[model samples]
Target chain A: MTESPQGQAPSGAAADVPVAFQDPSYLAAVVDLLGAIAYGEMSAFERLAEDAKMSPTLADKAELARMASTEFGHFEGLRQRLADLGADPFEAMAPFEKPFDAFHARTAPSDWLEGLVKAYVGDGLAADFYREIAAFLDAGTRDLIIESLADAGQSQFVVDRVRGAIEDDHRVGGRLALWGRRLMGEALSQAQRVAAERDALSALLSGGVDRPGMDLAAIGRLFTRLTENHSARMEKLGLAA
Target chain B: MTESPQGQAPSGAAADVPVAFQDPSYLAAVVDLLGAIAYGEMSAFERLAEDAKMSPTLADKAELARMASTEFGHFEGLRQRLADLGADPFEAMAPFEKPFDAFHARTAPSDWLEGLVKAYVGDGLAADFYREIAAFLDAGTRDLIIESLADAGQSQFVVDRVRGAIEDDHRVGGRLALWGRRLMGEALSQAQRVAAERDALSALLSGGVDRPGMDLAAIGRLFTRLTENHSARMEKLGLAA
Candidate 1:
């Protein structure tokens, strides 16, 4: 859960992709990771737009639209990175479509409050997991991941709106609390399935000959950290994890 | 319609909010105009996002997402300008919402191709109308309208896709040509409703004593230009006017 002890001092944006990408598996894994993140961003954008449509007020709609635009901005970067890596961004995203779609289908929020909770909890969990993976990548890729995962100032808005709704009706809080839990569960199920299927990506965690990677214990700790963060986010929304 | 014959030389970004705004009605009209455009941008963003969800391919979805994001970007600029003009952006948008919403509700696309044609013809018509109004405004607000209405480059993609679909099935062209006409009809109806309801906005055309405004003849010419432009856009999309 801690920063990779083997982490080198920041390289500060290397001129080219680091030499580590010369390894075919490392290259494949990085491509897979970026593709997954990019697709998730696109999905996030679409979901936020849907939420905007369902928003009760113009201000709320504008807020969601801004967040959606921010997600698309990040997606554009990841997409360009995929192309620079000589992978067709769409092709790279292809393998991820089913799992992400399935996850969204299974966890589609029923209303505005549910959508806000999912956006908060689901995005936090994904960001945490990706940040953990970023620890093991080369400097350039790591920097890109950090930038791509930057929050678009939606957390406080979600927290304010959700907590306000709960204040108006306590029953709303209980239902949303349950919704948060379901989001967490569905997200984990899909993520685990992706990890199981993507060997190159999973291998990025298990150390190679020269690169440092997480051990089993470290992987366990990483999940623990992710869970803790998810719980913290839920609590922030005044919902139980 | 031809350019304003009495047009002043471009003042090139006036400071002190232009003397013309000293007129209370002019200020209200400018605010009304900006509010209408801003609300339209937000509406366009939501609609494109909807179309994106209905798109058949990831590439198509990404394209629509990009357009949605672009609309939101313009919305942000207009929102800030409204605030700068001492109008609560949301309050300013309120008066225009019903008409814009009604426009969207009446013309909602039944499928992806219908969505594309609407985007193409609908946006082109709206942009043309706003640009015409821009001609009668102070330089600063005029520049903002011009910038906000700039096309997000969806024209070629929409034209290509819609035309390709038509090429695949001759029936599609006929259906979409009719769709284009409906979009034009619905848009003009909504716009006219808004103009009638918002007196100051309409007054912008019938001049103040010192400032030039369009005569009935000029108003006739303006509609002619808008219709001609709409037909031209449809023709470009391989659809009949």
Candidate 2:
């Protein structure tokens, strides 16, 4: 339920503090997480931009595609932060190749609405998790994280469209609600897979001096918060909870 | 060769004016071009960002990946401009999908150097063309085109790396140069396909107004300029003429 303290140095005099970057295990975990998120941002932007072409009108199309642009900004910030911490962004992202790839493959959207739903649900959880951990980071890194999670511009548009569709044709909301649920399920499944397989990252999450006291229970609680937000978002859009 | 007029208006006294939004036919052609370019930008960013991981150090990785970020910004500008012109970005892009897709498919990079070489040659020509077209466009649309072409940040980085690699290993340049040549050839072939198929776009290139004293030879010269730029760029990077 608590934020990961991986971003902090061990408590001591400044000179005597054990820098997390100096610890190979810690660096590896952080790098892995950063890479996963960075690539996620990259792929997310590409797909969203591509799907924007599917919009029925120019205004909606531009609005939808512009949302993807924000992802690139986020990707750049994460990439630079990773580099600042002595990690290669691409290499750091490589270990995430399989799980994230699988997650996207399994949840490939079949329509524009599905794509929007994925962006809404997937990016929402990511921003939430990043926002929490960002609280524990240095001012610069935390600032970057917060800035990256700022409004995606299309959120209101997405809500309006979804709500309008629900109002005009009640049957559509049920399908999209199911789609939203599946997206979350795949995301959580991938999160667990990554945590279980990457021990350095697992240790950073569960065993670090800075991250002490965090456990699977915390992750579960995080997911609970994410689902609560997702439900609220759906209700706001006139979709079934 | 000659600069393509921005976009033709639908009808009325303002018919000759170069508006950002054109008739559906002209809008379709512009979107076709922009879509192909946008998709190219998206894919290039993904590939180059991934390639940056192959770098030996964090600084190098960040530097390389940062180049990819520039393309995202260009993509955003083009998408927005498409919207301003009342063109559904995706629909405008859909018609040219096959050729563009085929070009990238046949020329997928086999390594980091290969990837860089493609960007260096491929984007160099694209920038050149966009620069020429900017002259014929209305101020607002022209400004967007010029801004988009101002810097191929990532492409230049790739060129720098490619040049360095050639310097380090003389033998590598020859092979990369060949790859560069092939990429340009494919690109030109695709360009011809687009020109031949999209009449409004071709008409735009031929000079839309049919002015009494219009110089068609000037258009031929424009193509010459693009070719010359491409050759100079390739030679600078140690690619064959």
* Model 2: per-residue Cα lDDT over A1-241, one tens digit each: 3553665553422222135456676567667767877877766765666566567754565565567667777888888777777676877887886887798889888887777777777777777776755554445555666777776733888888887877888888999989878887888899889878988766755666655546779868867887897777767667666
Native A-B contacts reproduced, model 2: 0.09
Ten residues in sequence with the least summed lDDT for candidate 2 chain A: A10-19
Q: What tens-digit string does per-residue lDDT give for candidate 1 at A13-81?
A: 544464666899999999999999999999999888887778999999999999889999999999988
Query: How many pairs of residues in model 2 come into backbone collision?
Result: 4
Q: CA shift at A26, candidate 1, in angstroms? A: 1.0
Task: Supply DockQ values for each candidate.
Answer: 0.78, 0.12
lDDT of 1 by residue, B97-151 (tens): 9999898899889999999988888888889999999898988899889999888
Across B124-184, the per-residue lDDT of candidate 2 in tens digits comes to 7877876676565546655666677655543555667778898899999889878877887
Q: List runs of model 1 lying over 4 Å from the truth.
A: A1-14, B1-14
Q: What is residue A93's positional error in candidate 1, in angstroms? A: 0.7
TM-score of each: 0.92, 0.68
Best by TM-score: 1
